[model samples]
Target: MQTFRTEIENPVVEKDIIDLANKIELFHKGKIDEEKFRSLRLARGVYGQRQEGVQMIRIKLPYGKVKSNQLRRVSDVSDEYSRGRLHITTRQDIQIHYVDLNRTPELWAELEKDDVTLREACGNTVRNITASELAGIDINEPFDVSPYADAMFRFFLRNPICQEMGRKFKVSFSSSDDDTGLSYMHDLGFIAKIENGVRGFKVMIGGGLGSQPREADVLYDFIPTDKIIPTMEGVVRVFDRYGERKSRAKARMKFLIKDVGLDAFIELVEAEQNAIELKTVAIDADVYPVSKPVSVEAPQVAIKDQKAFELWKSTNLIPQKQDGYVAIGIKVLLGDFYTDKARLLADLVEKYAAGEIRLSLRQNIVIPFVKEDLVPFFYTELEKLGLVEVGYNKAVDITACPGTDTCNLGIASSTGIADELERVLKAEYPQYLTKDDLVIKISGCMNACGQHNMANIGFQGMSVRTPDKLVAPALQVLLGGENLKNGKGAFADKVVKVPSKRGPEALRRILNDFEANANGKTFYEYYQVTGERYFYDLLNDLQDVTNLTQDDFIDWGTNEEYVKEIGVGECAGVVIDLIATLFFESEEKIENATVSFDNKVYSSAIYHAYSSMVNSAKALLIAENKSTNTHAGIISQFDELFVESGKINLGVSFSELIYQINKNAPTEAFASKYIESANLFLDKVRTYRSPKPLKGAK
Candidate 1:
């Protein structure tokens, strides 16, 4: 499925991913067909993801290097075409969302001036080549492998053998044995080692741990540095030939490598690699130096004193082999940077700090080295850009992927929810920023974009409505998920199902209680020390179970609702927006269409339909308050809350929401009635029958 060609040797390129900067200049004036231009720009690897109506563009960082100009370009692209922020991905790639589909090509052409590219960033294609964030530095490293990484990337970029594989291929480079920088969670993880007096690598394959998690296996314990590419070619061959094709979920190299076992897989890899006669450059010390990256201008840190500079120095600095220079890591919250701020920072990096910047896996940015005297000025400049925040422990530092906001298969907006949760954590529990040894990740779907299964607390998106009612589905919460110091990271705790909106609060409560009562212990230790009986007792005591009675259902004109309930987490992203979006600045532009909520006339099902309605929903409106076909106890529970009556008058629907927000007086004030309403609305939706698309609907 792939055709090989060089930027020059390739024949007629109907697609020019890059072009004269003049076209880019024209597009800035809104004078070009940017989308038409984007389809051709090669440097910026922008492509549509699995989901429809969305674009996933990948920005290349040569050897994971970031320059001030490059960062400025990234910020500019994001501000002009995307959501004015960028996500620093685990793969060391920067991703922008909700891209103005029309402007991508123009963006690509402009990117070429920097020599960055997006080709092979994604698809059933080879992805952005990753390397150790500490490739040239890290005291324990054997040698800088940046050149090798660059060589392999250049050789295979859009190569016929790799362009369209049976599945996506991921690659990484490591300069040390401890696999923290280049994650072992990859299809190909190459860590440096010395074998038989020769500088080489320990190549591990298929080691991703998401959803159906698996550890990558080490096939070649010692691959001479010179032959790394051929070895990589071998692994790709094994993956292409044996990886599963029918089930996309099972097609990742992690699955194939696990299934075939390392021995057989390596044999296959070796076979394919043998066919290639690699006649390339010699591997020598002069191949690539461990010098400071090419500097456009020397920076002058501007601060006068040392105290502020010391704090900045502690958090922002990383040791590099280059003398008189240290790498400064600027922790970017949630990998988001405002465009104007980015431009200013780029200018600052150009003026006060290093001319280049590097994006880190921890969703942070780095600028390598300036004189100790300039560190203070650089700190002040960074402070102006809001890029100097320090992070602590797993919980408050969350990782979330874009969900339904701009992705195709997204079941929810994990990013928005993550942002909200981060705000809540920062505002409410100041201690969690430094105390909790936990991670919270939100995935838009069960596909594990958020790595839900690996977090101490994780959420995966899913549909939870019943047969008759159709409302926003909920997240399938996988509680007690964790990864301990390279130990077996457990997935969700199966028994507890919580609605997504309530999840943050619930987790907060648990942590709060643990912090208060546990005798000075870590979060995980506290949970373990407290044991299950105490944990359940505390949870039960917190919520008065007696209040959840059949009488509660009476409020909806239905018989008392009670049921044998099992829990499932609601997809938090989509459901949470039911209210938040009703208030976000730009979104508030849409005026409300007033509707009468005659609680006496519309039965619970009708009410539920109206309350739960959002972008896409199916509901059959009727006047009757009772149903002849259903009995009292057939239906059991809603994903959001437990319900008993088969045709329960659970008064919840989108119409009810429009009614509430537009009330003459706040109807659900002073009480958490909105939460109850959400649960009830979700419950009613769980009862919808065959969903039929609305005809002539907008």
Candidate 2:
């Protein structure tokens, strides 16, 4: 592990890697529990793959922005530590697979040399902060959201409050009313808006897609940019304290808002105001770095296929707000590209275009700041890399998850079927090459990693069994999903389930029917007119399993017999409410509070101290085998079980002591007093939990 220490410049990041290395050793020595160890590794972005003895390292890229050097660093790391393949995710993260768990620390250390990180990329902590790839150049955007998104990622990277939350939280920033960021499906969605010459965002909270999809409700129509960070901090605090903790399925922020009602949830967030460090922290948007293309004369290149060049140019080039500049969309097939192509692409962008690339939410790449006259030159250069395919963000550009390829949660082959469907579109529906209205996304499971439920046509991987007990890979066809635009949208409805082998046939029938009968209507508009039942009935015959074939028993991309095996997903860390662990965490919180106090961040210090007290009380409550689902519940129960019942006295009630955080100003005086109160309360609770001696004991 010391081998990486000399390579990493940031001491803080170096310590994180060292800590993970030490924990892994401790876990191997049987000093740490599997659940706790799993959480630790996951927060560092080391995920267990479907196959045993390897890991998937998710490299976090804020808003999908990667410098040319950073891209080369990742490629080098991939070549050194794992396979040469890089997989871009729907959240704008890059994942490299089939890595040995023991070498992750070294792998991370190498990536950090170029200022790239994997922290909080795969865990319950705020998963990669995603935004529109066209953010800085979008003609419809009021202001660039890149800086604000960066601020959020930096603020919460290792914040004490969200280190071990019940579920993962996702945040996205839409560049414009186009809602290209898909604001409707994130835990907290921010759409860029300017009102009265003031920059702000239209906030949407609690929207998510899973086994049960829920659309987020409008939180604020327009909130000033300065308030976004503070608002998010308060909201996360409320969630950490009151969000569901027992059942994994109900642990998402979406479920919490649903159970308590959005109004009540907002009230809780408002109550956390006094505990936030900065009330209106303004993000310095000007400091946000954006790369400009090198001013180079375009080199003439001969185009062998003029027809193909025009087709590619027509669909792949997006107009930029900057004059004489355009953004080129490279439709990365299934978001997979090798290290060789990666290094070449990095060099090409650095020489002619911007020295940076934005990974799109649709699992593609956008090279912004390309000069309009250099389109042909770029096409020829990219053609050498086999990246000049047409129909980027069009019907041919299908978004898909790894599915059975690697993801532990995948039940069927999403990538395999996605390849087939894309082939079908290119071969049969060539007319769709110029159409951008249709969206297709796929996921291996109900987790919606592929953003399936947000597409015009979606497919979810599943399994179906014949009467003879033979199981075959299947797909849950979802329809009628619409982007809706302007911070509003609808999730797709599950219309039908068909054998994986017939997935192409299902797409063909759906498209054929839509084209022949819709009379130029968009997919979503036609779906509304025809309704869910109408489509369900149209594809109902494909659901029959009685007439099974040998091919149906085998999953796509595999020649072996299909076997349904799903390992546990480490997307959300497990609940580890061990009494000793809780007490240990309380002390850690106190230490953090003291550190914050020294830094003069009084509000943060106060909140940390308050958390120490709550956790201490919760430790005692757990010792008594009492339920501690939410922090609000824990406070009420602590008072009832100890203070109110006169078992332990601290002059005043626990409610008054804990509630002081919200009632008083976040001054140095109040913060110090509150921390003292927390320390005293913890001492009392510690004594109470100490094993008492019997009469006439030694």
Candidate 3:
């Protein structure tokens, strides 16, 4: 383990890995609180799997861009640390399961060698910043959004402001109006737009997909590219200050914007402008290194089946803006691929294409910069690796999460049923291999990890009881959702709940009805016309649980009777308010303030000091069982309970003391005063809490 510490070049990253190792040791020795430890590990990208005792490591890949060297490195790490399998996530992250908890530090250290990271890949921090897979090469895009996405990802990788917000915040960059990145469902979404000969983006804020989906509101019709980073900073600061924290279910930015009108939220965001670190952080769109295809003569290869080759070429190849080059889409089954094929693919890309790959939002892979003339050679090589699948984003292509396979929140086997559905689609509807309009997604639960709520046809894992008091696996069938292009989309409507075994039948009935009476209209168009009630009436009989047989008791991909068990979900943001932890955090914040002050970042220093005071007050408030839902709430509550009640003397209202941060300009004098004030405030809170006995004090 010390060897890993010595191997890391960056001292900060080395410290992070060492700290994680120490924390894991403490946790294993029963020297740390389990819940608190879970939060620490989760923020580092180590997640608890459903199988227990093993971990799922999420490798953060910014905007799904992976160079061949990085892919080879990841494949090597996966083979050494876990099984030789990598699962691409809906957020364009790569995850490896069944990893020993102790090896995570080494695993993360190994990834850093290739400039890949696992930091902020999970937990309450900003997750991987995703963008359209074809961001750089999209012909319709106003400009490439890859560099902007990369800049944001870099800015917030270890930024303290969003390290522990009310909940996780998701951001996305769409290449064009097509919204291929699914901007409508993210917390903050940016669509590329050119306004008045300037590179800008159509900004959307406060949208999210979960148990409750909310469409984002238009924050700005267009904002200059230089301003997006600063605007995002203000939005995050506002959410951290005013967003919900007590109730995990309602803690997202969407709920906050919904509760307080978007106008009020905008006002709060605007108020954060003065405190932002950078007013205009410029990202040169060309920062993303352009790659040229390796010069390789077209290899002579014979197509075994001409019709199969034609089908694959027509459906899987996407034309790139670059003349004479094409992007090949590989339909990854359930986003799972083995290390053997991965290394081979990496070799293929490095030898012939641009030495890189883009993981699609559809949980597939796109190999760009492949010459059209070399398509036959590439296809033959891919065929050997089993990477030549016909359906890229077609009807036969389905998106699903790990579900009961690994995720703790999984209620049913999403992968199992997705496998079955894909099987049925290939076997029964061969024509769908080229049909790209329909989307079918599955989630083991309502978390929408599979984006089920935004799919043309969706299935949510659930359970139902029979008349005999026997519980069986079930799925809530949803329909009529699609991306309407240009940042607009619809959420699916739950039409019926049926046994898991009957999911195929429900799909059969829906497709049969659609084909018979659709009158040449698209799936979404027909769904919009017929409405939810019509679909419900058609599939209503399948919801009957009384007619279940013995097989219904068993879930798909299992040989034994189904037992519904859901573990604690890690996506719920965590907070700790132990007196010691609070004091420790305040000290760390003071150190951060000092560092910022030394670096001449007065605004950052002032905010860090302000956060320290709020954290110290929050410690006392939690001691008194006061609500700490938001930073604003904490300030007011601290004033009401501590200052006014004379329990702790600050000589003035806590609000007045802390609110000075916003009232005064951030200067050398204010930074000094604020740092002193935060120090005194933390000391006072500690003194007041020292004599009091807390119920769960460790």
Q: Which candidate number would show the highest TM-score if scored against the true structure? A: 3
Number of clashing pairs per prediction, in order? 51, 0, 0
Q: Give per-residue CA lDDT, model 1, range 49-120, as digits (tens).
A: 544444667786655677777887777767767778777775677887665444666665555555666665
In the range 592-698, model 3's lDDT, one tens digit per residue, is 89988998878778878988998888888887887788999999988888889899888989988988876677788989999999989887887788856333332
Error of 1 at 155 (Å): 2.4
lDDT of each: 0.53, 0.89, 0.89
lDDT of each residue in 304-339, candidate 2, tens digit only: 999999989999999999999999999999999999
Task: List the candidates ranked by lDDT, beginning with the highest.
Answer: 3, 2, 1
Whichever of 1 and 2 has more lDDT, that candidate is 2
Stretches off by above 4 angstroms in model 1 are 1-44, 49-56, 75-84, 98-103, 279-285, 289-324, 392-395, 434-437, 466-473, 478-495, 513-698
**Cα RMSD to the true fold for all candidates:** 21.0, 2.7, 2.0
Where model 3 places Cα greater than 4 Å from the true spot, the runs are 1-4, 599-604, 664-669, 691-698
Candidates, ranked, TM-score: 3, 2, 1
Q: How good is model 3 by TM-score?
A: 0.97
TM-scores of the candidates are 0.65, 0.96, 0.97
